[model samples]
Target: MSEQLAIHGGKRSVPESFVKPWPYVTTADQQAVMEVFKSDGIIEQQRIQSEGLAKEWAEYMGVKYCIPVNSGTAALHMSLTGVGIEPGDEVIVPAFTFWASAAAVLHHNAIPVFLDIDPETYCIDSDLIEAKISERTKAIMPVHIHGMPADMDAVLEIAKKHNLKVIEDVAQAHGARYKERLCGSMGDAAGYSTQASKTLSSGCQGGLFTTNDEIVYERASLLQYFGEIIVPGQEREDQKYNAYGLGWMYRGDMFSQAFIRSQLKRLDKNNSLRIRNCNFLTEHLSQIRGLKTPYVPNECEPVYYNYVVGFKPEEIDLNVSPRTLRDKVQKAMKAEGVSMGLWQRLPVPKQEVFQNRIGYGKGCPWKCHDSIIEYKKDDYPKTVEFIDSHSYIFDVNPPNDLELMGMYVEAFQKVMGNLDRLLK
Candidate 1:
């Protein structure tokens, strides 16, 4: 273990961190691509690879149908459009998430009603969702943020009672299970991202929309194309005039489909490795004071995409800001020959795109019970408090050898040893 640590923390390697160099791309993936390349079929056409990949993904996700798109954002847009979310409609989304979650709703001319998240799980607070729903509420897009499954049971119940459509954003969670149920299987429809950073990445980008409803599935399929409902005897000329509804060119390419299909096979094994690393980190970090690891539900099995650590500034008696702490830790790690820093930059709501009146019309309709919601500095007491003290560790593709895991553990311990000094 010590020798492995030395190898990982080489002479040129900085102190605070070292990202696992070798990425996991199985041989099966390469073979899959070669098969596609050699096949005498339309490489860029949507009918060939996209449809086939969608079918296979549907089976993998245990859904009746899956619609493959160019990107996850496109999938979300299709799902919202399929559910008939139009202008003036409001969709409830968590504030502490990727901007795509809210932006997708805005794209369809629907408003996004931002909701607070549970401090522990870091998912939208299910209890607060009911109160946020109004007459204009059309859908609830709950993102399985950072691979941790949201309170789907509660979210689904509320959706049912309110007669609202539920669109599960399974972008961060591909094989995550809540009480043995897959993340994509819980809602009316779900969106999965095959972006480079995700578990089932396609190297470039791709997206999948899964659903049991045949009508919705068909609508989403048509939306991915130019909304032309493919019919018997309707050739290219006739199909142009027989447009079904508004649509976008969000079709996935043959190459991305081939790569994603190959990567999907090894997702479970990779996720298992991530879980093992997370367990080790959690066990070690739990013993330390003033730092809290993420809380995973007993019934919920997360894929462990990004391991977040919360620092209790009050407990530490440190006068330094969260940004300061983040910088110092990262610098220290770099000095120790580590190769990483904090995961995320800032919270979603804090971004200039959300604050400024750029493409997104007047302003967002997000509000909190305690304070008036302003995009700039309007006090998001909970959000601000959390972001100020929180730092994250990203565990991407873990080292193939388990010995490297021990090196990470030792490096983490070394960083924590002088935590007080680093914060100061």
Candidate 2:
């Protein structure tokens, strides 16, 4: 390794040309998509590909029912709606997750009560949830962000005590398990995303809603298709789409549906490889001072959707902002050919949609509620800290060739060890 920092003219470690995941396309995948195109029924009545995919996914997740939708956001909105969350009802969610997780609450004219996250896991702090619960509290939507399962046992116990519905936002955690129990199967209903870049990518856009409860399944099923009713015993293709009430057109596309079936065959294997790479990265990085590696509880078997590393200003003993040192490290790491950066800059409440109350004219849900809720940027101290610092997320699904991971190890070792030069 060079003594000079990469930014100060040391050689790069990893090669930019090293590709990952190699787009696992097969001849069968090509034929299936091509056939769909030639059939002249892109939006056919049956949606066989979508239905079959949904059924298979149901078994994969160990849920009795799975409803395939156009996107993860749709799955969440329908799930909450199916669970009977109405306007004025409040759902507790993490302030530090993707907007879609909280936005789904807004979609149904409900209020999303954002809570701070557990600093170690970067997930909603189960300890803080009870404080936010109220009469209007209807559900607890715990997102398994970056594929690290949230403390489901704590969340479930809290929900049971308070009579709140539990919705697992498993968009990034396709294969994650908690204490031998699968993630999506733990909550009353769980949502999944198989869009491009997800653990189970279809090279397109898609989502799934899974649940064990029969009533919840039926409700979400009808809600996705404008309240369309399906008669029992009819084949998926022969079922009548009897529309009765208001619903969103959250139907899944045929190509994406068939495309994901190919990806499912490799989802578990892909997750295993990701876990190994993550362990390798963590083992090396954990030795560095002023740097935090991803933390997984003993009970969790994470799929590693993201190997999210953290850098807290308070955790570092330096007087200057951690961002200063973080930038130096990142610049040198990039120069060393290791990609690292923040995923989302702001937590949900800090976004303009929440700050300026600019969602859907008059901020219907935020202000439309009987008791208007006030949002302060500093209310969630931990989430704000995460936004201000803790940048850079590592993709767990690396290239087909595992050698890039070796480069990743070398890159971090070189950068962190050369901090004296980096600070200069």
Which of the numbered candidates is closest to the native, going by highest TM-score? 2
**TM-score per candidate:** 0.87, 0.92
lDDT score at residue 79, model 1, on the 0-100 scale: 85
Query: What C-alpha lDDT, on a 0 to 100 scale, does residue 290 get in candidate 1?
Result: 56
Question: Positional deviation of 330 in candidate 1, in angstroms?
Answer: 2.9
| Residues 1-424 of candidate 1: C-alpha lDDT, one tens digit per residue | 1222233343432333345543356688788777787877554343566667877888888898788888898888888887767776888888788888878877776677777778778788898898878888889998888899999999999999999999999998999999999998988888888988888888888888888887777788678778777643334555655667777888788888888877777778888888887787788777766567889988789987777777654556767666566566656555555444565445666667666634344453332112133454452445556666666665435653345445555565566566754554
Single out the weakest 10-residue window by summed lDDT for candidate 1.
Answer: 364-373
Q: Quick one: best lDDT, which candidate? A: 2
Residue 311, model 1: Cα distance from true site in angstroms: 1.8
Badly placed stretches (over 4 Å) of model 2 are 1-5, 21-28, 38-46, 231-242, 312-318
Error of 2 at 246 (Å): 1.2
> RMSD, each candidate, Å?
4.5, 2.5
Model 2 error, position 322 (Å): 2.1
